[model samples]
Target: MSQQLILVLNCGSSSLKGAVLDNASGDVLLSCLGEKLGLPDAYITFKFNGEKNKVQLSSNPNHTGAVEALMEELKKHGFDSSIAAIGHRVVSGGETYSESILIDEAVIAGIEKCIPLAPLHNPANLLGIRAAQEIFKGLPNVAVFDTAFHQTMPEHAYMYAVPQELYKQHGLRRYGFHGTSYRYVADEAARFLGKDKNSLRMVIAHLGNGASISAIAEGVSKDTSMGLTPLEGLVMGTRSGDIDPAVFGFLADNAGLSVSEATDLLNKKSGLLGLSGLSSDCRAIEEGALEGHPGAKLALEVFVYRLAKYVGSMAVAAGGLDVLAFTGGIGENSDIIRSKVLDYVSFLGFTEDKEANTKARFGNAGVITTADSKAIAVVIPTNEELMIAQDTARLSGL
Candidate 1:
């Protein structure tokens, strides 16, 4: 038997989140988060066996340093040496994948081909891969893509009404992100609802720094919020969700700004933080709103409004919704946000349990819907790392 440990490397533009798991038991042996690497500020932390700890990396760290740091901690802080595999989270599949697959040079090249579509994400993901290859040189590492689940979305839903030539020439269509998380939660929802995995329809809301809603029908992704890019999705931490294209030309004509500059403003300066001046984080806005901050109130309201509208539309797109789930930092932790989302859909058989909701269950999956409610409301903490580990195991035959 192969005593393999699969490590998940999730490298974002400015940070890294990784976890090493024991494939036999699905236990997370080690998880590390390196923040601000390659940026002005940087710090590294390691969560050993899912415990909060100060697993430190050296000063002036970058992506490579972050990977090295985690390996050192594993050696020092007690992890089995049977780690035989690594799993990487690659964001954009760009029609190259419909499922998680084994990683090789060709897979790496395929990911690189998707860089233009995901300029900000794919390169960082590749960095994590390279870092693992350097540190764990002999191990088999697999890649689990975030766009793989949405491959089931029909072209009518995934395609944009733009010139077919651009899409035909550039492979430019809606390649959604968060497929791993959505798939993870959707499966859990089916289990929680006691529905057969292949026949259930669920709407999963993954709300966090980057948020998206997916409508999964008969265990396949039918529609999702994010489009061609993350910027097109629901209003994100800093990215403006959806905007009128005509505004770009108008801003250029009236404000004398370039397309790139306008694009930057929408992606970096506009969203909850821009609308709420108090903070980009949902918790901060909720607190600020309680303290009578106008910007905070506006931000909170807009965020919830965006969520409710999308949930309704997703239900319509799915033909109907059997279950509605919440996951991610804000979705699982924030009761206020959950309440707001539920309130908008009361007419659709969603009713909340105040007592159960008040007791926030971080990382636990359960129904928060009222006993009599037809459409269930659930809080399912996402486990992207576990999904990565599972994929890695399947590919490595461990």
Candidate 2:
């Protein structure tokens, strides 16, 4: 049997990230990124066989141009014909899809119908799908949604406490994001603990520039942090998470800002950046906090407190926590943050192993809690691209 390779495409508003992975072994054969799309200095960088190369694209390049450039690079690397299918990281499937599936006419319509829910992401996802179809004709295309895993959330957990008509007519309810990362880490946490996923109650915190947490019971999502969009969760790099609805009116009255401007302020200028009045990067905040910067100290404190509170709530939602796992850019790398969070949640019977916590950074995965602790706390690195590639290969029968 020949090797099954999957081309995973993640299209964003201003860039494209593509990776070719071996389905059986989960090894990344090649990866490339096209940046500065729709700009005069658009270019692509490819990394393969431990070597990196950069290629320039036409001025103001679009998704089609990026795909064409990727194809040429693939052919040059002799990986074009080996690809079994293309997988796309779609942001929202709404209620139309519960899991990863092959892309078809009906699927396209469903994605299009959800454009209003994910205006910035769904359109770019569709562009990548269309471009892949045109460039890699006869190949199967799969959509792995960022919201699909959380579809298992009970209605009570997902529903907002709003007027029934608003929810019934406008679909105004919580639809969590970061489903792909949550799903991958949930299974990994189970495997790492030597327990069956269906028997484990896990709370995974995916902390990055964009962050969220999820409660998983028996391998299904029972609750998550993000709601309706990515902006309704824990404090992120710039996006304000979980603010009072009345803040809008307050801003309009005092700041003389319109609703759109207020919304932009919350989504683009708030969170760690707003609270610290410094950089959005967590490392910078940590450094400033260590230096006794009042703004950074306050930001760090609020971020930790909010995260611990959510973790406790999720544990309740899961009926009790057996495992508390951390992943993503911040979660996996920041030992200080992890220690602070663990200190806050010590009542949950987590005793931090300081040495182990410090050693678990830079791609190392291990339990960060003591053996005598009632619950296990671990750092499990997330691999969303591998999850997407596996789903695509399985759906395509590769």
Candidate 3:
């Protein structure tokens, strides 16, 4: 097959990550990260041909500036001419999109319409899309939404207990995130297990700084931890996941905080950081726990307990878990976390291969359960960028 190059862009509020990949071979030719965008000390880091380099960007760089810098890097590496299209990682498509689609005026409007649902992410994603359109004029742009895969969820799985009119009017229901990661891992899990994708029932735990779990039955997302936004599910590095709604009113009355402040606190100040009163990084929390720090131990326990609880729920939602797969940063690297989670869910017939779990880190992917276990457990590193590139190539007819 001939090479089909697709430039994948994942833009955050103040950062842009770009990768040029051969869609046919799934090999990344070049990758770059523009950090601290719109700040005075903005800079960009690039990795290509096994070499790493960093360069300072203009003062107060914006998304367009970052895209231009990426373009320059692409040109420098002679990859600019071979680019076929650009794929954007959009965080929310609401109920409007069920799959990846080419970006157009109508799509942009649809994205804008979902701004209230993903207030922080959709705008940043739109910025990246517009910047890429400007920098790479006429290149087909395809949007791969993080909520699209969960669109297959049944009505009962997505609807809230609130009045039906609210959901009908505002679309206030569960729309899971990390779908791109889930999509990648579900296929990988099937391949690793040597089973047909549609025949497997898998529960995927995407544990990272921003964590979530997904239940895939017959190769389709049935239920996921994250809801309307990414803040609804598993305890993240800083997010206080699955908190009671009353906490907002209680904090307002007792702590004299507004709804906005309470939301910010939950999304930014809680989770491992709040529980441990230390760092948000899990590695640090694990270290502190090892050192017998009470707060860190509590944080670790709560995190693991919540994670295991979700795993159990996802297992049920998937009907039966034939393969319990772990992905994302923490899922792939943290044997301690994985082992703890498995121990909690041992009732589900998952027996951890301690040796195997420890070995499946740092880009390694393999089964981490005993051969005789009823259900298989595997650690598969997620590659969302490659998924995006493939979708872009197929959708754009590259």
| Candidate 3 per-residue C-alpha lDDT over 226-286 given as tens digits, one digit per residue, 9 for 90 to 100 | 9988999899999999999999999999999999999999999999999999989999999
- TM-score of every model versus the real structure: 0.94, 0.98, 0.98
Whole-model lDDT for model 2 versus the true structure?
0.93
- Misplaced by over 4 Å in model 3 are 1-3
TM-score of 2: 0.98
In model 2, the worst 10-residue window by lDDT is: 55-64
lDDT of 1: 0.86
lDDT per residue (tens digit) for residues 148-210 in model 2: 999999999999999989888877889999999999999898888899999888999999999
lDDT of 1 by residue, 1-52 (tens): 2367778889998799988777788877777889888864567788754467
How big is the positional error of residue 33 in model 1, measured in Å on the Cα after superposition? 1.8
Better candidate by lDDT, 1 or 3: 3
Q: How far in Å is the alpha carbon of 389 misplaced in model 2? A: 0.2
Regions of model 1 farther than 4 Å from truth: 1-3, 39-43, 49-60, 78-80
Worst 10 residues of 1 by lDDT: 49-58
- lDDT, each prediction: 0.86, 0.93, 0.93
In model 3, which residue pairs have backbone atoms overlapping below 3 Å?
none
